[model samples]
Target: MSVRATTVLTHVTASAPILLFIEENGACNTTYNQPPLLILERYEEEEHLNLVPLNRTKHPLCNYVLTNRWPIDQNWLYVDDEGLHTKSIDREDVSIAFMPVSQIQVELNLHCGSDLRMKRSLSTNGEQNWLGPYDYGANKWILTDSISYNARRTLVNLIVKDINDNSPIFVGLENEPIVVGYPESDIEGFVSPRFLVKVEATDADIGENAAIMYWSTDPRVVVSPNTGDVHVHNTATIEDNYRFTVNATDRRGSGNTGSIDVLVKLLSSEEIVVITVQNSFLDDEDQVLSALNAAVDYDIKMLCASVVTGNIEPTYKRQQSDDLGVSLRLFVYGIKSQEAIKVDRLTSDLSDSNIVTVNIASVLSLQDHLDKLQICPLPGRDTGLLVATIVLAGVVLIITLTVAVCFFLKRKKEHHYDQFSDRNSLASRNDSIKSSKSEILPKINLDELRKSEKKLQERLDAANGSSIAANDMLPVIIEEPSKMTDVAQTPKETLINISAPDPKAPIVIQSIDKLKDSGADSDDDDEFGEKNKVRRKSVVTFNENVEKIIHLEDGLDEESSEPDIEVYKF
Candidate 1:
């Protein structure tokens, strides 16, 4: 089933327009030479015309404009001047890509079916071909991907909607332009002409259709392009009719303009300067007065005073009065300036007009204050805090390094001590063990002890065989002191080699105690063989356990025991 369709590439001068309808079965049916319905239509695009599908019957989903309303519903989506919009929609499963209206034809894709469905056939990417031919009579259609689709096909419908819907509106206007300034009243110290009047407008359209630009037709008046802000000439006089029209135009151009008639008059222009006096301390009223006098001399337009307690930084001390014109700031700070005064000059803020700082310390007298108006002393510049901070940081660093070094040295010493102690204990234990091993042996020499015992036994035997001599016997005779006899005086001990007595021989024994008692003190002691040849002899007898004992071989009886007995030698 072939159908006839009109293309934008060429125009046919036909009496009636034709339309092609695709049926549910794979059939394309055409209706030609349709009776024309009268409708007024206009197209600014002269080169081509794009015919859309179902352009008339599609109704807006809402009663009035709901874009500006708050607390919208959740389920359904709405379309406004900003294109399609949804209140709260999930973007995870279905993603939305925004493109301009001109790119609609290029982005059009037919998925499972050529028709638009809320569920299936929503969108396909750029890789797939959008739509092609189907069978002539088949009830269902299929794609190359073997996806079965309902053959009821609807084309990609281009919505012929959201044309130029609104015009610009003007905001906040007086009956006529107010007399903002006077030409003759242009005094140097007044507050009237230092003001700004604002003129503005708004548009509710979206995108390029909503951007409103502004301009003025008159030479005396000027309008800001972006904000529609109106600025008049400062030198405007009252004789001039400041009447002019301010026009606001949307980006669509042509008939989208909104305008308002404004009549402005310049009563006069006066250069008024405001002088703000900021001071504290109730006792400094005299200083404040002196400052005010200085302002009067400089033609200060506005004078004020602000009281504060604590100190303020120099940078933030200069208040920004961009709306106010040229003014002087006299900061009568009650702080003393002996040690802390250090600044010379600071940046002046002239965002709107030039502003200068006048110090209370510099304004001692009227003449001094006058000289300072043209040449104010610069703000005090102090760097003591920064320098002190740097010094403190350096000291901390030194202390930290010293502590670290000390800790390292202490650890090293402790490690060395542990090693030394271990070595010393091991050495001492080793020496003790070695000494114990050496001492586990006999104390005496075996050979020397055996020889000493043999010598002692031999001596015992030799002393048993020896005998005493006969001369070893002593006779029992006493010598008197009166007799000068030459005899051995000391009692003598004679060692005589004597044999053992025969077992039959009797021994003669005498008590030496009786002989010692009977002293022979005879006067006739020298009468025996003359004095020099005296036969006086002290006799010693035999006894047991004595050194030598005399023995009579046969002359003496075997049982003789007497006191003061004598024995003779052979």
Candidate 2:
């Protein structure tokens, strides 16, 4: 029960020597050149011949031969004995035929009168010959060496010998040394691709004298050196079965072919579908939002998802939410809580009137999407508080200023009144002096005062004629001598006294100084009294030089027939 049968040689030529071979047994024998043995035995005395002549030239020894005899002819004759009592005799009808030999051992041992070896004997007379067999200890067969044989070498030296001569020969592989390299991958097909493949072959018997030949199941594959590099002329196929064979040869025309079965199952180009909602009315149109949707769909489709940042949005924050969504779908196949999508609002608050505006940005990522997107409005109280504060400040400032101005004006008025009252009051000596002087000051000029006494009397009469009782028109008088003396010290008083009183009117003094200056005498007064009906009397008397005026009760009697000057002090 061998798994495989050995190569068999079914046809043998009759013109050549035919050999019977048993490969594993290592034994063989050659066919004889002539038919060797056959003889007949009678079964019932009717004698049957088992021999037949086979005239086929291709097998000239197909017939069996029993005796070395030809066809015989005979007639009846008497037997004769030599010279005594026997007569001469002849027997004629004879035949040459063969019958099958029953025992091979007996036939080989049978003695025959005709010697077939003697027909071609070298010696003239028949003689027995002896030969000696080789007497070595024993014949033995051994293998001294082995080699790698290709089909051609095995066919010539090993295969042909095994078939034609029953020789003990077989093909063997020597395990030749070889160098193999994987191809470089980057180059396209066979043109110095990044993936490189190469092989160098060598045989033990030939050293570097080994050549390589290659064949591929795929025509698109190209092998460099036609024998070594397993290069892909075209891109490797993904779904096909391919085989590559490398035939390593020796200088002796021996070759060994090894094959490799390759399943070139190249993956098909990926089907990538990027979905974008170009029309965006709100944040929903953002790339992140769109990408999120894609994640859901892609997850359902069992496709990988990824977010690709592009010019539309470069950074993570600037990236459109929709694009982020898509990228998440691609990378994670869906948006997970851990990989949250960051949402950024691209908005402008035109209504906000602050000179500086706030920029709102948010990161929507696995960790912070929901947390970052929460928006809170500014408190309303702040605006009102600012305006109210400004109004209150303005009002307070105005009131304070008003109060200051009023206080300043009132203070100024009080000061002015105090100064005026201090200068104008009657209790003040300064004010009293001014009043007294104003009352006593006469309207008369000094040059007019120097007129003739008659002219003065006429001017007095003229002045007295228009006044009441003429006493009111008189000069003011002073009761105190000191006050009277004080007025006399002024030059203006000398001018007022020069005008004499009129004889018909009484004199009244408006100033104490005028009274003191009046010289009242009895004889002059009697003369002036007869002419004048009224007289001005001084309230106090004064010595002629002392001028210490004292009031006189009746000593200066009204009927003393003297003119008196009446004096009064304000």
Candidate 3:
């Protein structure tokens, strides 16, 4: 229902002023037409009514009303057939209803109950017309009212306040607990400017809520509240691994806190002596270690050395005549400070020698330096074992080759000897065959035999002409080759063939004078005739007898045959 007010005046005059009354559905009311002044009241935003103001301005009428009358108590109003009324307005017969209106009208409509209670509604886009999260600043909100043919819109601004709701969280260190390595100070009881690690965290809140402060309870380390940088303290010991909790807290209200695990590794206080030596010294590990130990004036421990080859910084100086030389790097540890100085001095003195340079560095810095140079530490034990295995294998190979060569030489020698023996055996067999084909006997010297036979014949003739009787003399039988025959005769008149004398027959020789002086005589004429017949049988009898004597002188057997002639007959 709509309320309509009609102005009624009892007297109207320009100079006396016009008096007017308000009538609503025939109900009278007191009214005075002063100067037709329009009053606009300024109102602040009310939480319960959900009434927000876009632009509010102070007016003189609102101040005059507020200063003259007591504050209006908020009460529920109802509309009836008489008009819009309240209990206080019924008693005083004076009521003013202040209804908000919009400056711009649109096509949308907003419906409210008679009690002026607002309910959530959806727009044409099917989205609920509601407020979003509260953000600090002026927030714009559009309120629409729609009727059958027209709609009105009002613009309202909302200023949202802030509240501590979000907690600070780590930013970069999200996957695992942060692990950082820091070296302890080389000097005793001193703290170095070693940046351990940086921890970063962020908060989803704004203003004072996003301001994070870092803190740690670990005694060995300290965290920068503003920068989140963790630093090691002087009390931190070497070779220690420490774990601590770092908290990030915001600065709003009862601050929301976030915690993270951080691991800090404190390295040892050892120093490294980097020695660059010529490649010639790389073969003998003992010599290199000894020289290094002597130069440093300290005993080098085992497994504390690492060898590498590469282009290193601060190389050795070379002359024009020197060839390009490779460098071997030796990284030695376990030496104290005093020895490190000695090493430095020796390095300067031996700069032009096999030792190129020796540099002393802290463990951390040296590691960084090596990393930049891309030099890796060689494992001493593994390298040594590999070298030993290679050397042993080489030695075994050499021995095997030597043995193989010796065996080959021995086999070749044996083969040559067998060939020589076969050739010699074949030659000997040919000689034996030739010797058997032509049989040879002992040679008799014909000239010497004839000479001796002539001498013997002369002796026999002289003996026969001497006083030895025919019976006393042995008959010399000389048989012709044509007259040789086998004949049997009386023993007193034996016949002999003198052509072939028996080589084994014995002959007796005596002096012809001695035979004559013996005076032996023959009596029987038959014996004398038989001697004459035997002598006539052979012309070479004396020759054959002489040959028999020569055969005896030439070493023929004597006892094999009896005498062929009788020299002296008894």
Candidate 4:
């Protein structure tokens, strides 16, 4: 028979003892076999059969706080059962390791250090894995079991806090000791507040750390806290010069502050009196000052003086010429109001020979007058245009005059040529007249004349039947006079004489000496008679031929003892 025991054991420990007893109860009593048997049994507890409490093994997310720009590679927290435990395990049975989650894992892997460190700077409003209130789980440290090859991971949240590490620095103050002038008063003697300068500063920190405030210790100087604009107030007690410091502080406090120096100058108000004089009267500066002092009865302080010469308007007297005189300008100050009035009145008097004029000077007026008072005035657009117009007009006038002269010379030459042509024509006419006179009065031969006379006598004697002697029948020919005396010897009588035997032919007797006497008398009449004397001789010769023809036609037998008369008249 086999004895087998089946019993349920609860709350048993490993390596504990167990007892088994068998009893016979059907035939006889079997109490003698077993007096009490105890067996020693050892058992192993398997990991899968063990139960673990939920509270003992936990996966918790740990949070840690750090500042930006903290020490690198510094241990912030340890991944162990004591400080960063998430599982129930012995320190030697598990391996601790850390890995950054998300994009920060790449950053953590590059650094080989065991401890955690902020490799990069963090900000409140930054786009980094760790922020000012970093709530995202950025890292996970693992507790891996060495025996079971299981891992227990815990999340680590890194919070980056902002610190006030940067101080406020002044900006745009490179010209360190800033100089400002005091405000000038108006005609009512009331000075208005004016802006002096603006101060600026910058900070590197963010949030409340970057805000700045401005302040000044000087009573007269006021600064705007937000805008950093400086101004002056209550200027009645201002000094000639003031040197003070303007401070700039961040919102973090006095530890982060900056300062700069500023200078303020208070100048006394003054009036500028300009005195213009002719250089001929007061060219020297001392002379101008003396004359001004004498004219106004006050000692004048001349700040500056200048003299200009050449082609400038005379400051004293009016003149037409541009080169009037030298202009002397005197910049005078420290004159009383009454003296200024007196100077003005004297200048306006025109009788005052020294000073040209005296008037209040302004910045613009002084600059303008000084520009115009140059020794050589610059030619402006209008001046250039006037010069161009004058030159053009002069050129046009010269051209016109040249053309007129050329036309006149051409007309005069033509008129002279016409006069020469007329003289030539008149000379040609005179020559033609003289040539006709020579041709008309040809030389006669005496022998031919005698022969012709003898023939005519023979014919007349045959016709009349009267025997006439040769000497009596032939007509006489008178010689022409060669000299003026020969012409005067001729008598003033009938010019022609002829006697015929026939009653039908009237007897004609004319004296040739009378024609010569008439010609001689006409020659003594005027100056032109001398010129007509030659023409008269031509007429005398022509009449001689006419007498011969008459004697031949009428068979004249009677003849006068005087030479046959021949008359020539022009």
Candidate 5:
């Protein structure tokens, strides 16, 4: 079947139906190599069959295929049910395409110099072709096609499917050596998710063909698929001299890729610490420093004792033999102090191990949580202060000595006063004895006592003569009226002669009934009034021994008369 016109009217109005269909045959004449098609019959149910296409035996064949390759040989033919049909060879800009079907499109124009081109095909769409891969001088198509109406004027956007035209290019991946983690913090765990390196690529191809994906062969590292950032997956879990390669693959059909070598190194975690300061306030002249310097190896001893013990307690204050001080030495270096931590001297047991070549850091300056290092003071920095302290201490010493001497003198004076008191007491005792010796005037008069004794004898003789009965004359008791009996008296009056009683005599002591009958007006004494009085023994010889005998003076009451003193024969 063949179409004679571009437009046709059909009686089908409810819906225009596309009635295109293909045909196949076993022995139809194989001529133009064209595909079979079925002849149109009934296309719609509602439309009248008024339109029809007749088999056009006479028609022009327009070129359909386009190619980028230059034509070499030609004997073009089309085969179909009629076997093979010979096609005309009209020279144009080679409108027909080549066999392999290249993606490159070409538009033809003129040649260089005066080489005139042959005006070939007059077809509206035909273009002129010359002798090169591309027509650099072919500027004749634009103005002619738009204004002159001679050349092909059409802009077709052809999408050439990717065919792996380019390999991936790793951007900046020219054998560059990348190191991870700061040298100071070489430990494996320190490298966080922070990007170590970024892998990138550029491809001349467009769209998915140019898109690059990153991949690594090393297990210790991984790369982001979209960002291409290389990262440490696990450093400690991998082996040493650990290295691998990374590939940048495009999304092309072949996955054409470019690669770069990656080197993984476990940077050394150890560092050598070199402590530099402005100066250390160590007493270089101290003998302990000199001796310790000799005893210890040169390398073990640091810049100064103070440098080691800067913020800590001064080494001079450290105990050589003090037990408590030894325990408290570390305490003296409390971390609260803002000064750098240090030690005075290393013990023999720990000298080798504790005072090791440990690293503060490998950086220019050790980072103390981000603060800068403080400079040390100069040696013997307190000389003037020490001198002033010494002067003040001397004044204090002098004052203390003066006070002590004054106290000693005062105590001596007190002791002298005590001695003077003892001497005065001794003098008083001597004077007392001298006064006793001089007191010989006022002697007791014995004549008055003798007269009183005579009177008493007369009264006793008179009373005995009147009251005695001849039969009972032996020391009989007499009861007489009280000398002035103006006062009331109970049981009359009792007079006792108070004569000495013979030790052999059986004496009848009368009871004191009269005293018991007396009223309370009589002077009375407390029951224990004499509790504190000391009792004494006294003896008096009545008429000095008749012969010339000596008698010892005894303690007696001065008021007692000799006659009133009664001596008991017992």
Candidate 6:
């Protein structure tokens, strides 16, 4: 069953507007001129305006009209300004109905006996649409609508939100410029002007932003970008200000700039000159003299003494001299030409004698001491006699020692030989004395012994049948008394051949004179006659002694028989 109910809806309108409400089917209606209690800005788009409803009562489950106007329809009118009035044409003849703003819409929709359906429809009157959510009789509704907004304001919101959220945003400042010469921040009088100068500026912004252009506030200073070379007037005075400006510009024509001030002043025109003296003892030249001209001395006389010793080569000395000469010449030239300060006197006095001794002594002390080592006198330079004397002294000492030892040994040997000779001489002399006394002594009575030996020999010969010579027997009776007395008185020693007392005595016997002249009369001697003569001498001596002994014996025998008997054993 379909029913159409008509109510004269009135609206106060200065402009077309869309309305919002619920449909009789109980779904929210976004249709134009239907269930419209809420109004919004118009939608002129070709599509139907989508309207929304606000729950005026602030209810959670339902939406109701906020106003109490009796003639309210599902979605009808709204008033922006308050003076608008509306009267509805009531159809009293039909079934008259009034809603309690909330229950009326619900009852009407429930009386329709069907679930609600919603649509977005346009009004036949051609009013512009307002976009909002519509909840005619639903339990809930979300109002949605769109109004033309500012895109710029939306972007600004996003930016503001990022800032409030502490999001990252990058920003950079322009780079500072670097200027030539003295910086403005520099202390005064620190740097002088008329010096070569340069200036530069940099910007963090890219492209042409980083380019630094230089400028000069003072015309005296020139700034060049192509070369980055700054040149100032050479004659600039101390009071002169050479200000250079450097500008850093970005592609956006934004940049920073800096400036430098350069002051020019004259240098003191006084140069300090210090002189230090050095002496080398290990060099050959003694007392090196360095001479400087009058130009180097305000008082005009400068004499320095430099000495060198030991490694003492000519070259080392020459090198030192050359250095001294150069220094002196340079000093003189500098003073005379006004290029440097002149020396009126040394600033400080120094004596290098101690230093020279210390250094050179340190080097040479390790060698043998000059006094200790025997230095050969340069040959040909010393007298030759001294050298010869020394050599001779050495030789004499050696010879003297040799002679002393030899003499000592020789004397000892001589002493030993003397002792032996003395002993031998005493022994030999004793033997000779004993031998000579024995030989010279008469061993027996020579006369008597000779006579007895001859008688014995004759008796033995006669017994043995050997003939005795008559001449030998005649010698016994006819002997000369004088000859016999001569023989008897002569003391003679007998010598036996077997037992001779003298070692030098002759063994073969003969008369002394005959033996001495034997060689001279050797031819005249007759062997038999010589033998007879020898026998006669023996026989004569033997008979004489016998006669004497017989006489004596007879006398002795007669005397012995009596008391006064005298006898001798012959």
Give the top-scoring candidate (TM-score).
Answer: 3
Give the per-residue Cα lDDT of candidate 2 at 377. 28
Local accuracy of candidate 1 as per-residue lDDT tens digits, 95-159: 11121221111111112222325323333321233443222222111111222323222222121
* TM-score per model over all chains: 0.24, 0.16, 0.26, 0.23, 0.25, 0.17
CA lDDT of 66 in candidate 1?
A: 18
Once model 5 is optimally superposed onto the true structure by TM-score, how far is the C-alpha of residue 42 displaced, in angstroms?
A: 38
Native-to-model Cα distance after best TM-score fit, residue 358 in candidate 3, in Å: 32
Of 1 and 4, the candidate ranking higher by lDDT: 4
The CA lDDT at 225 in model 3 is: 89
Which 10 residues in a row give candidate 6 its minimum summed lDDT? Answer: 154-163
User: What is the Å distance of residue 177 in model 3 from its true position?
Assistant: 1.8
The RMSD (Cα, Å) of candidate 2 is 42.2
What tens-digit string does per-residue lDDT give for candidate 6 at 1-570?
Answer: 232333244543333344434335444332212231222222111122112332224323322112222222422223222211122312121211121111111111110112112211222122123213333333222122332222111100000000011111111112222211221223223222323533334433222433455555565556664434566545643232333343322332234443444332222212112222233321322222122221123211111213333332221122343333111111110222212232222221111222332112111110121222237444564658788888999999999999999999999998889877865688887998899998895555678877766854554444434222332221111211111113224323222122221333212121111111122333344766542111112112332233221111112223344222222223
Candidate 1 backbone clash number: 23
Report the lDDT tens digits of candidate 4 across residue range 175-293: 66655444334311322333566678887554576788899887878889889888766563555456788988887345488888876554222333445554333446656566566
Summarize candidate 5's per-residue lDDT along 308-403 as a digit string, tens digits: 432323322222232222111110110111122233223321233222221111112123212432254344666777888999999999999999
Q: Write the per-residue lDDT of candidate 3 for residues 76-118, one digit (tens) a residue.
A: 2222222222222111112221112211111112223331222
Ranking by TM-score: 3, 5, 1, 4, 6, 2
Look at candidate 3 and tell me the lDDT of residue 363. Answer: 19
* Candidate 1: Cα lDDT at 317: 43
Worst 10 residues of 2 by lDDT: 154-163
